[model samples]
Target: MNLGDLAYPDVPTDAVHLLPLGATEPHGPHGPLSTDTIISVGICERAAERLEGEIPVLVLPAVAYGVTRYGSAFAGAVSISEETLRSLVGEIAEAVGALVLVNSHFEPEQVETLRSTGLPLLDLTRRRNAERLTEEFRAGSCHAGRYETSLVLAERPELVHADRMTALEERRVDMPAAIRAGRTDFVAMGMEQAYCGAPGEASAEEGSETFETLATMLVELIREVAA
Candidate 1:
């Protein structure tokens, strides 16, 4: 059930609450600005469906802004301070004591901020979780590449700029490595078009499969807490 769709009296106290955490940032020229948000919501919704008979689930409204400092060079990139994000998340977590964070944005600051909340989080940046995802994602170059593009394609195909996606070439910049080396933004990390990985090779079939993995991971996390 969606928390936003429920009245005060209808809210379930025993259900595991999912808070979709995402960012509003540029996803190259082919992907939508809300790519991260879309993916987070997709994972939460899918997980909620899977947990229906096993455990009650309530998906909260998405928090669509995060510490997106890497995309700062882009026009559409919007970010909040880590302190601010931590405070906001802390408040939300306090209110919904059984909440779990389902995040799609992988920026370092964002990851750190979410971790500071001490809430159960499905952080895809971790090796164990990242390894379960597609190869492109594990390589850490999938900012708006095949992995993310495939997710967007699976969740919201109409939002993808097909013309631009088809015309683009693969950019294999190791974003995580570059960030570790002190690269501040997409431009510094050699992401000229604000994207990396093989976006041209993205397919909805791969996306659907990836979503299943993500949802499964979320469900497992919820079960660990709900138990």
Candidate 2:
């Protein structure tokens, strides 16, 4: 449901507030810049549909900005400090009795911060639980890859640039390796285009399947938390 719909006074108090957080940044030339937010909203809306009136799941306005330092090298990428991201998420969680974070980006530091907020955070990072779904969809790589491209194609087909996929390159960086070496050298990792994986393989059908599975998983997690 829309955020405006939640403003009704008769709305139930025990409803689980679902906050879809995302970033407004580049996701390769094939995908939309707001891919993260779009994916999050799609999944949240699907989950809310399944829960219906009985679950009182409300879709809050998505956090359109996120921490994207590595991608900042790209022209359209914008990022915030880890502290700012954490504080912002914490404030939102405190405002609601319980929060189900629908995250599309794989920012570990930001995820950890949101988790530490003590809210019922549901991790949907490509590097985490979403990895399995990625495999199922044959979506390779982690960023602006087959999975993300497919999801965007499924949810917002008009926004994708399928013909440009062949020009994009796969640039995978081992974040853990850099972290262990005490070097904040994300730019030097060779991800100049801020992209990884094959965007050309994305399809609307595959995207729909991945979205359905993710929505189901999120709803199940919410039910467990409520119980």
Candidate 3:
């Protein structure tokens, strides 16, 4: 049951409560700042659809703000502290029967905050065939690249500017190296527009395939955690 549709939740006692997390951060010159939220929601929605007859789930409204201190210096980025996100997620999880966290933003501090919640969160960023997808991208960078841009194309096409999503392959930057080097914004990493990886190669079909893999992982996670 969708929580938003109810005046009072008529949720089944055994239903899983999935909280999708997103961030108001820059993706690239062509991608919207809400890319995190949009893709997270699409992943959650597909996962829920996959589990429809197996275990009922309530997909909660997404948390649109998060700790992105590493990218905070970018024009379209906004970040909160890890402590703030931890506190909020913990408090919210307390009210659910079975809880799962679905997030797309992979910032170090944000990921650490979510894991430290000690609340059995389900994040597909590190799981799923996520490794394979990231490996397919340039030096494992996913931000505003083919992977993410494809996801947005599949989920919310209007938000992606196809014309601008071109030739970002030239701007390959190793995000992990940048993080290790303590650089915050894209400009510092030789990516002036805050995007990384190949965008010209992104297609809606690829996005659909990515979600199929991620949603399968989600299903496995829910079964394990809810066991």
Candidate 4:
């Protein structure tokens, strides 16, 4: 359900507060601009449903904007600074104990800042490595690519554009090397297309599988942390 349903006049000693952090940015021509937020909220809702009344996970309002520097070259890619994100997360952490942050956009610095709060935090970005799924899908890229495309297709089919799948050749750089140099330098290594992997290969079936696996993993993590 909704946030109003989980309202507690005072401290919600009986339930776990789920703050779903999301982003309102472009996902490419094939996906919606609110793809990140939509996916995050959807996953949180599913997890809440699975847990049922035991945990009483409350769905807080999602943060619609995030630090999306890499995707800035693309249209409709609005982002905030790491400091701002940190402040937002920290404030929320001060009010809650266990937080399941369902993040979609990549912002390592902000996430690190939030993690420093020492509250029970669940970072979904680094939760599950997509290497296995990437190889399994034969997706040449990662961002807005096959995996993401498939995810959107499975989660929100009406948002995907199956007919606009066009192959765009770009140079691929090693992630470890980019990390060593830093994010600014990493931005110079790729095209301005706001994508790296193969979004053309995305399908509803693949999206469904990927999302299901992720949701399952999140459920387990939440239970573990709450215990």
Clashes of each: 0, 0, 0, 4
- Please report the candidate that would top lDDT against the real structure: 1
* Runs of candidate 4 exceeding 4 Å displacement: 4-13, 124-141, 166-176, 182-187
lDDT of 3 at 59: 88
lDDT of each: 0.91, 0.75, 0.80, 0.65
Model 1, runs deviating above 4 Å: none
Error of 3 at 209 (Å): 0.4
Q: TM per model?
A: 0.98, 0.86, 0.92, 0.81
Indicate which candidate wins on TM-score.
Answer: 1
The lDDT ranking, best first, is: 1, 3, 2, 4
In model 1, the number of clashes is: 0
lDDT tens digits, residue span 71-117, model 2:
66667777887789888887887877777888887666667767766
Cα lDDT tens digits for candidate 4, 118-176: 65555654525444344523333355677677778877787776776555443354433
The lDDT of model 4 is: 0.65
| Candidate 3, RMSD to the unseen true structure | 1.9
